[model samples]
Target: MAPAPRAQPSPVAVAADVSSAPVSTGCGNGGPTTHRGLAAATAASRTMYWPLLRNAECRHGLPAGLLDALVFQESRYRPLVVSRAGAGGLAQLMPRTAGDLGVINRFDAVANLDGGARYLRSMLDRYRSVPLALAAYNAGRGAVDRWGGLPLNRETPDYVRKVLTFFNEDA
Candidate 1:
């Protein structure tokens, strides 16, 4: 038997994850909440990457706060973090994905952010659904196809919820 069709998330939930609307192209408009989220990160990391994040946002038409939320979840703004799965840099891109996205140096903050934003834009375009796109980002597109929605696995759903939480906080 096939898996049941998943219920679509509400529009507001989708928008909160990633909005196409023009907003200040930085994390949380430099609000107190944004600072609170970045409190764990070092000052240099926060200062150095905000502009790159903004640039990626403008170039990819992503909302900065959403992108910021994603980066926070992915690596906590640590440019050199390498996952056990070998995903690295601020975006935590895997090797194959980094190559496909034309990111030569995954540790290079600018390249990683740009590649991540580009890949995210493509996912959003392909799925036309924020949650599915986020699931695809976390668990890969093949899993999304196989599961017919968010996977039953714990990581993907938790990832979506956490990223959405950060995004909603405008962090």
Candidate 2:
């Protein structure tokens, strides 16, 4: 009788394989990003910023349209605004989320908008679709991820539609 030897992979090879795999950048849909794509995304943007979205946009590499849509949906550029749900500032970020995003004062227009934009960029990267990203932003990423799409939350759909339909004047 004869037996064959089984070979095991080396640690270096394994490490190489792991390192060579694609990594999520946590910006713009977890897909490849570029200033050009970002430029296109924000191409239709017409928002005025106290600190200017251009800086944040350049920092996180987000499409301007999506950012503008989110801002319009959340607070319509009112950094001092707060939702009944406790979302606040121009981006309508919750206190905890805002804090995690490095926003010391959510009511501050610059801080809020920057934190919100960063969060939205992450959502876009995670979901890879504008509607899904908007849904995650409105209903929480857990809900969108759990439902395998937009959550069943009543307001999520409306939020998504409103953000996506920013092109329509009446929207």
Candidate 3:
């Protein structure tokens, strides 16, 4: 007899884990609830991600807050997350991209932070602006290059806005 096939998880289920699975804050409100399909950047998460982020910043020539905000937007400091689009871990790195960055294990905090910071830094250096860099990070470089700036895609603008708000660049 042939082995039975396992059912694949629905996108909705994967997305719930990606954006809404609460990390233990050990505080009130159970680690802050997700609002608008994005996790809240709680103080607990900042404390957790700070050490790895700081080290990535120093080694990658990126600012700590920039990486933090991106992580806040990407995974909310959740290490085991896997996105509906198949991106994985804290940085939401796709497997191929992670491999290219020498990130053999996306769930590994230090490796993910370093790879993510390096990727973000390269995007920033290439685009020379926060919006463009963020758009590239979210929508890929080809999209930005074709659009000649931030693409008019629905999700990319909101993504940039969220990261900017967390980075305090929205002012």
Candidate 4:
């Protein structure tokens, strides 16, 4: 009888094995190194403008991470983005809403974030829940009030879910 043929590794298997291996940073100065440190550094770098975020949070008594997550979800932290509906900046505030929030410069990153955070906090207070506040934030407070909290619309429900998911994950 012929000897059994040896099994050959599949390309997918080989690729997966290689990908499972730890990547080397190749930093010659290696004073200290850790995956946790690298992850922390990456997260920190993403929030290098944290002082501005913190200021907004402090001024409005809202959680900084929540504000950051909302801004990221709304505009990906872009200070100059405008929605077709006339929402502007990092928090995507409407011009009238920005005026109501006393945001002097709706296009300014700090001012926009501050106004958005304050507005969200007020909505939270009004609705008494994050999900409801998120729904109001996405859909309008009138819609939420009409529904006695979160709107019954599918789009608003999904938007609230996404915002809360991001907020929880980031926190």
Can you tell me which runs of candidate 3 are displaced by over 4 Å? 1-42, 169-171
TM-score of 3: 0.73
Instruction: Encode model 2's per-residue lDDT on 1-171: one tens digit a residue.
Output: 554332233221122221232232333332221222334323333234623554565466665445655776787666678899999877898988987888999987777767877887788778676666777888888877666666655687767666666623321
Per-residue lDDT tens digits of candidate 4, residues 77-99?
66788998899988899998999
**Which 10 successive residues of model 4 have the least lDDT summed?**
27-36
Per residue, candidate 3 scores C-alpha lDDT tens digits across 104-168 of 99999889988998898788778666667777889998888776766666687778777866665
Q: Please give the lDDT score for candidate 2.
A: 0.62
Ranking by TM-score: 1, 3, 4, 2
User: Judged by lDDT against the true structure, how good is candidate 3?
Assistant: 0.68
User: Taking the candidates one at a time, how many backbone clashes does each contain?
Assistant: 0, 7, 0, 0
- Number of the candidate with higher lDDT, 3 or 4: 3
Predicted model with the maximum TM-score: 1
State which candidate, 1 or 4, has the greater TM-score.
1
Q: Is candidate 2 or candidate 3 better by TM-score?
A: 3
TM, every model: 0.80, 0.67, 0.73, 0.69
Query: All models: lDDT?
Result: 0.75, 0.62, 0.68, 0.64
- Model 4 error, position 85 (Å): 0.7
Q: RMSD in Å for candidate 2, one decimal?
A: 13.9
